[model samples]
Target: MDKSQLLERVIELVVDITGEDEVGEELDIDLFEEEILDSMAAIELLLAIEDAFGVSIAPTELEREEMNTINKIVARIAERL
Candidate 1:
């Protein structure tokens, strides 16, 4: 799939995991500090993204910066692809 499609899927999977409808929300909003994502939820997100994109996220890639926001995560995944 394309980058945009991958991003959309990521958003959908995040919403499912976080139980939020973020369609009209800000992409750069911090889900962690916002309390929208907890530690367990974050792990699930990482797993889901890896599974959906068929790309592995290395241990060195587990920085909080890369996962700070939805936009950033999507960009990271796109870079991997």
Candidate 2:
């Protein structure tokens, strides 16, 4: 998928995991800071991303800050793609 579509899918995964519709409501919001994402949720998102896009992100590959926003997550996945 293209970058835009990839980003949408990532947002969907985050919303599904967090049950936070606000995730898409604010494209660059800090998920962890908002308590929308924690360690486990981040892991879940990584797995979903791997399933959806075949991009595997080891936890060690990026710090939480690097993946705290939807835009950042999409950018990380795009780099692997």
Per-model lDDT:
0.81, 0.89
CA lDDT of 4 in candidate 1?
73
Tell me the TM-score of model 2.
0.95
Across 1-81, the per-residue lDDT of candidate 2 in tens digits comes to 898798788889998999988788788989999999999998998899989999998988899889899999989989889
**lDDT per residue as tens, model 1, 1-81:** 887787788889898898889632789888888888887887888788778888788645678877878888888888888
- Give the lowest summed-lDDT range of ten residues in model 1: 58-67
The residue pairs in collision within model 2 are none
Best by lDDT: 2
